[model samples]
Target: MFSEWKFTAKEIAEKPDLFLSGHRACAGCAPATVLRLIMKAVRGPTIVTNATGCMEVVSSIYPYTSWAVPWIHTAFENAAANASGIESALKILKKKGKIKHEHVDVIALAGDGGTYDIGIQALSGAVERGHDFLYVLYDNEAYMNTGIQRSGGTPFGASTTTSPAGTVIPGKLQNKKPIADIMVAHEIPYVATASPFYWRDLITKARKGIEVDGPAFLHVFAPCPRGWRSDPAKSIELSRLAVETCIFPLWEAINGEYQLSTPSKVLALAPQKKKPVREYLKLQGRFRHLFTPKFEKLTEEIQRITDERWQRLLRKCGMT
Candidate 1:
């Protein structure tokens, strides 16, 4: 028939519009774009469970919903638990001949707060039990849905409402939680770190994640214009810089086997040629405090964090 194979117009037309437009996401919100890309990648019957955060609050307002699929929203820290229950129920019903379906995919969505701080227990349990679902953490670095408070995902030297940068104290004193590494320690079927700047890479990884037979975790770097105080249009630029600087390396662990992606490969090939972390931090207001002369230590701290993380990743992947 066709010379090879491609996503024909008919096939594109047949893909479900799982996420609808007109939601209240801030301009240049990467997580919203992540949601779109993830939905496009998953091409089967799917149900979504959302933890209470920016995405859920915006997408499922009263008397309206931006979701085009079966979706449920729960408390700030229970999306994984809800998805686990839903997947279990679907399996039981299908076994008893109550429901006829070849595939029913379960997806759990949560912001960094829900994933890193409050919901880690639920996520760990779901992954340990090997639930057939995907857990995506849209890490905007702070609790953007609330008052721009600091969360476990917040990077060092970034000023937030709770972790203020003042004369006495620098921004956040701690580095971001190593979420992807934690998932890998669990030995999940798939664990990945991604950024919205690389849409094609993100989509490919998302497809692979959803197709995994057991648990999969995707930690996405989703920039927030409002919380980060960056130019709304620079969201994509910031995302790219994060990866290029090795502040957010792209990598994956499939059943404990690790491999670095494009950007990480470049870093590994020529570590000295990597982009400066300052070039990435200068774009965001959250890191503004680090630019001043007296805050030089903070800048060094941030760079140290980035380089250490990158080296650690290389070592784990055996690329060192």
Candidate 2:
């Protein structure tokens, strides 16, 4: 029996070429990046349950599968439920001495729509039950697989097919929901927000999630170029912009205590000069209508909200 178990930072960084190249993720899908990074940290037998979304259709298109590890594509709202079943079965099998190892890591992967909106009930149930597994949410901020539709995780004032920015309502009106905070409220051992731009921080959180004995939820803000109306080449750059601009703050919750993953020094150096929200908004086809003076007013409103949120995070991190 193994006395202790944990993955080192270096070991986690040395991920093998498991997720083969030539997969069908969008030109710059963050989920693909997350899958590769997570595989590096996980050892022994592992199983993945993916929700019906972009990652499902792109990576596993029938006979042409790109996953080098074991994966299953479940319903759009049942990835967490399916993973729970798998974990229970593995536990029974191991107890009966039918399995070689004492532990089999199981993970459920889902897009923002599945995690924050549709699949939330199942996710809440699984975590509340104290299951031993991890749920990685690749939040592209919308229903990218179906089309550029608004999801609950999508930030306010972001245009989408469902939340169009017209003369009436200026895009998605509601602010982005704090799903990580909800998970932390469940009292899980680990809950974190990671970004593809921050690979080191991403790997660190994933490694910790796996070692956590109970349910762990990781909300990863992955940039979707096609959906977000941005250049595919600027995917990573946008990821960095999201954090530096305080649009997406990186942090973690360990047993209900929160810690800002980005250092104070890094926070201090954040761009005092932020690009106009229009610069970020106008690139996407969804927000094409938001170019007029009225739209400019909406842009200012968004900026104000972003500033307030950033200041709040600064206070939360004890930097204020």
Candidate 3:
């Protein structure tokens, strides 16, 4: 199906802006770019339900909004629930001949804090109910909108306000929650991981997710300049490095079957081609402490964890 999807630069340039400018996302904000790319993939009428997080706070300030489509700002724990209700209401309206459209896509957007933590229950319930909707989690890894607090999605050794690196502790003690794996466990029609750096892959996944008949989930990595203390200009670079290092392998699942995306597939087939995870860590200030002599082992531990995860993913894809 993805092979059938095609778009050219000119065609993309001609598409109307579904996510407009003039709101207040930070400069070089990858989540904002993620929203734009997702909107670019939309083919028909759509409604968006967004959880309260960085994107919501920045995109919908006061009387203004960046969304050109019908959008609702839901509480932190209810975006997916809201989307499920919207999909059901649309179905009812169509049955009653109150709505003319044959189909209207429902999309739910949330950050890591809202999705991996507060909103997991709602997301799980909606998917289990076989809701016809797409849930996109733009993961910046921390509660960026709430002052960079540590969250379930936060990686180990990443210092945050709550998980500060110090003498006794070296950051979050837990591994990043395997949210994508959890979504795949739901046995949804579609589940994918994406990054803004891979525009084509991201767009294709978004379109596929929206077109699926049942619940779909896309866990998108969105680099945060503020939260990660990385250079604004390096957002895309960080995104690329993340995949190259196997820190965030691009992959998808359909009907509980896993397949690595093209870029990650290459690395999986030739393990030596994968870059060391340190290249990704060195670019971000959150991992600065890991490079110190006192915490040197933490860096090695992070690399080992990344390698283990990548190998496990390869096994799932039947590449190992």
Candidate 4:
């Protein structure tokens, strides 16, 4: 469904920059990478609504600002609703000939806590209303802004403040909430999953979202180093692993027709190319307890789950 969009990295560079340097995001933050790419693809007027999280705090501190365009930072759970309101007003303003912009795309940017849990209802309302806007969920997999607590988007067996590794329950009890699939179920004009690991693909998706006539949702897999307790420099590397391991498959659905964008080619011959989940787990302090034998079983189960999902997706895509 998204194959119609076309863009090259060189062309993206020629576009005007919306996100400049000297921002306050953590070192090697995936969200910042995605923001730059999104900004590069944007043309004409644009308004951004940011939920209270790392992106808000880091970009719009008390006395400083990092955004070059119009931005509003609302509470942690109402960014989508706020953006919808802005879009509605803009539609009226445009119809009245009060606004003179040929292209003005409104987008809501939120972290996992805001998107997957607290703000899900508001987001659903906005999309279901068929708002002419885009909602970008930057899935760092936890509430990274406020001490890295476990959010609904946290992956299974991953450790977090609320779901820490304990004697009874090892890490998060449930897997991720699969917010992308939920957005797809809304039957929007465009729904895609992308990562900062592939900046070109991310920019392409953003451009497509802007051109789409109706609601568009883009789920971004952003790796959190401080929260995940991993090396700050391995943000993109970890994100790539997430896709390769099937923990975060890149796919999309347009008007409820599902299509796999990046197939589970990495899982085609699992035995030969499988990277030990231990390597990925060991990088984070949350899964520290899983080094033991009993808790190691959880890791085994997670791998099996990921493998199974990849196999299932392959069949769905008719790649089997």
Candidate 5:
């Protein structure tokens, strides 16, 4: 619906740098880029709660932090809870005229491990209580900080330290959990799936989620070069290929009404128009085993799931 809004590289570059440079992300850190785009959406005062993960470790080293706004480093499982408390306190302070908080945006950030597994309970509670804040999860498909261990967000047939691709087993045996759908089931005001490759959509979604009165969730697709064993320069390219292949769709569920985002809307017209899953799989080392002739069955299995997911999303958005 918001196709007319356009942003240029220069415009985004000139925006106030809420996330400073000189952090410990890899050469092409997609999560850091996603953070930058999200922060650009709201230039005013912001209070951020970050969970223990790659972002918190890299951005806020002991002596310094890249964040220009008021930030809190909470435990891995309670960022959402802490954010809820902070937001509630802000409301009371604003009501009592104790703090001059006009446009302060409260945000909770976590990784896939923190969001899908460790922090799901706190997230559910915060949203159910009708907190006015945005919860964003940068999904890298595994626990990237400690090690490359499989997470609930990990897709099938991808190899992690725990879910290794060996002689007996191919890779992770289970499909990824549909966390976005789970959030939608909560009947929240807004929930969205975004990718760092589409900065405009990411920024717009973050701004809308912040403006909404109720809780909002944004699941961002951020590629991990070290974890995925992919080329550093191809991170953004892989993200785009992921969307064009329908492996990761760009969509939003707003107030229980589902619709594809700008880029996804254009491609949803014809599922056949999207690139094949092989184009997306071959680039990642984690899926390299599936490309071999011996693992044809595994590759086909992954393709089957991809087709099913793409069609399901289409039906959900009423594009079918």
Candidate 6:
């Protein structure tokens, strides 16, 4: 039904913005950009359930909304559950001839705090039940809506309010939870990682996720300027650097088969093509401490971890 939805860069540029302007997002909020891309990819009637996070708080502040489609604001831990219910209701309505549309895309949007921690169980249950919907995780790596508190998605050695870098310890001690892998383990029909820097790829993945027959998951890397203490204008640059550094590999799993996305495919095949993680980390204040003499070794550890993870992904994609 959505075959005609495929779009060229110029076409996408000319398309109407489903995520309208004049809302309260940060100056260079990548998550806000991700939302716009996702909405632009929709080719039919869609219902969006957004978790209580930055996007929700900013877009839907009482008496105002940025969404052009039907949108529901759900609790922090139940965006998936809400989308599941919406899908089920759509099915029932269609069966009863109450709704004219045969297919209405259902999308659940959440942040790292909601997806990796609070909403994981709900998301797991929804996908396990094989609901026909899409779950998009806009991971800024911390609870940026409330404060820069560390979440399960926070990378190792990254400082946050809850995991501050101090004399005794470096930033967050634990590595980022592999939420995409966890979704793949659920055996969903489609699972992918995206970044706002690659708008076409992100839009393609969003379309695929929505068009899939069963549940789909998208883990999008959204740079948080306020939380990461990075320059607002460099958000897109940081996103690109993340992919080049293999800090966030672009890849997708379709029906249990993994394949590296175009941007990261060359990096996987040619290890030397991958930039050093430091190139990506140095721009963000959250990782500034890692540059200090006392915490320099922690930076090396982070590099080791990133390389290992990239290698693991290459193997999974059968590129290594």
lDDT of 6 at 3: 53
Model 2 lDDT tens row, 1-320: 11254556676556565566777887777778877876666766788889999888888877888777788986999889998999998999999999887788888899999999999999999998888998999999999998889998998888888998878888898998988888988998899888878887787787778778889999888889888887888778777777766678788878887778863237645555545455566656666666676766777787788878767766665667
**Displacement of the residue 158 alpha carbon in candidate 1, Å:** 0.8
lDDT of 5 by residue, 1-320 (tens): 22344568798789888888988887888999999899988746889999999999999997989999889996999889989999989998998999986757899999999999999999999999999899999999999998899999999999999999887788899999999999999999999999988888899899888888889999999999999999999999988998998889999998989999978887887656788888899999999889777776887787889889989999999988
Candidate 6 wrong stretches, greater than 4 Å? 1-5
Model 1 error, position 23 (Å):
0.2
Compose the digit string of candidate 6's lDDT tens values, residues 182-254: 9999998899999999888999999999998989999999999999999999999999999999999999999
Per-model TM values vs. the true structure: 0.95, 0.90, 0.98, 0.93, 0.96, 0.98
lDDT per model, in order? Answer: 0.88, 0.81, 0.93, 0.82, 0.90, 0.93
**Residue-by-residue lDDT tens digits, candidate 3, 1-320:** 33467998688768998999997999889999999999999989999999999899888997899999999985999999999899999999999999999999999999999999999999999999999988999999999998999999999999999999998799999999999999999888899999989988999999999988999999999999999999999999999999999999999998889999998998887878999989999999998898888898998899999989988998899987
lDDT of 5 at 314: 91
Consecutive 10-residue window with the lowest summed lDDT within model 2: 1-10
- What is the C-alpha RMSD, rounded to one decimal, of candidate 5? 1.8
